[model samples]
Target: MTGKSRAPNLMVFGVLLCLGLLFLVLPAYHAGNLARIMVLAVYAMGYNLLFGYTGLLSLGHAMFFAAGMYGLGLSMTGWGLSPVPAFAVGVGAATLASAIIGFLALRTRGVAFMIVTLMFAQAGYLVILYFGAYTRGDEGFVIQQADRMIAGIDLSGDAARYFTAFILFAVCFLGLAWLVRAPFGRTLIAIRENEERAQMLGYDTTMYKLRAMIVSGAISGAAGAGYALLFGYVGATFATVQYSIFPLLWVLLGGAGTLIGPLVGVFFMFYLIDISSAVTSAYMLIAGLALVLLTLFAPQGFAGELRKRVFAWLP
Candidate 1:
């Protein structure tokens, strides 16, 4: 094909893809669930920065995720703040919490670090659970219809909310892409490969690890904000230990080392869960078994394997 003809074809394809996505989202679009998936994807991306890129295993990321959600929920419900400001507050709280946690967690390495993070997260969960009156604890927080005005546009409609979330996801995704390609990212990879060697080269490994933690936590908080806005509710279940593991699974399932892998993993898992639930009541068992099979047979995950097969056939 000529270059000029190819350009037009690509443009048409892009437009078609966008239209298709819009159509799919429009009909089955539950504001709450869409928000949940988007935010969960964001949350998983943050974990990917640590586990996928940095090779850091954290078992307590849900602490920050919950913190962000509850922080937004409390601000909007208790203080009558707007979604934007409330979300910012939630991000701040999660960031600060992560900073403190990172400081302590960074002191250890490897499995010890994972254990420390898990313990901290569990402690956070208990704290939220015990304060039932303040947090509504197990009952969760109900979101009320609050005015969401952005540049003269009232974002009360489901479509508006979905678009808002898509915008946020795009921004975060782009930002992460840039971050992973930066010099700092190279240093993180080095640390992941050999911390002792990175330290010998004067790369303050601890500082890099802590920085990653903060970035991951902040992004997770941003995701939580999206969740709160989408669902108009927040609760303890959001921060459970299981939520933390899912992101790890997503990264691994999608080919962790690559940038687009987590997204591929999310889409695959979402559809898999949707289809499996429709087929049987024992969806969880099936999902678990699928994960086991994926892990056992496709260690590099589906994306990595697909890429290899496609490239092999091309040449």
Candidate 2:
């Protein structure tokens, strides 16, 4: 690859290295926080693949997320499967769900698409509630610490959990960075910019979008599965609309279509709430104000703005 093509890979590696190093210095509390941030960053990155790159707006991603979570949770808790296999099942469930949803929802465009997704997600949430006998309803069941171990390593420990989250984030980050630089990624971008033109160019736009949904859902599902496995709890709350919106906020704030935007947005939002909550009960107000200012000043998002002004080479 040319130097220009190599830049994104180098940047991704550097970010992963820095994240790995940060664990050594971070306090246990902050380390735990970072772990959560990393997991959520994975979710935002998945959202970016569909919304940012493909220009498909989904308001019901929580169903796929919850699919992965409940897939893994129920597998281990009910069927007595191992963590690795359960995680795979969760990702698979998400992939399948996305494929089905994409086929149906992709038929509609714009606001109709968003509404369809939201309706599907709400239906999924209700299903979880209806099957309370297995899902445990709102009061989620906890995965015992003993079941959280992998190959004799205890993931419940601070260092182990942090490193695991870091590894998961790094893999997804680098993979996406590489993907967006690939030909398929370029096609998605083309479709995003102008679907009709892409179709005139002989591209199967619908197929590409369906594929994007599958990939996006798989990644989001992985994040959800990781969160449940690492944190040891899966609940109906994740299936709620708020969880779906969180990824959108992160992607928009970080810079949609930018490789590193998801992580930046997740880190920023997580700390914004963390710091604001300590000061007052009106944390949501503070967050809203911050978001408003960000939208007014940096319409393209934090990383998006930086890419526009400072780093044209940023992937």
Candidate with best TM-score: 2
Q: Which structure among the candidates has the greatest lDDT?
A: 2
Question: Number of backbone collisions per candidate, in order?
Answer: 0, 0
Model 1 lDDT vs. the true structure?
0.78
Clashing residue pairs for model 1: none
- Could you tell me every candidate's TM-score relative to the true structure? 0.87, 0.98
User: How well is each residue in 74-126 modelled by candidate 2, as lDDT tens digits?
Assistant: 99999999899999999999999999999999999999999999999999999
Candidate 2 colliding pairs: none
Question: Which 10-residue window in model 1 sums to the lowest lDDT?
Answer: 7-16
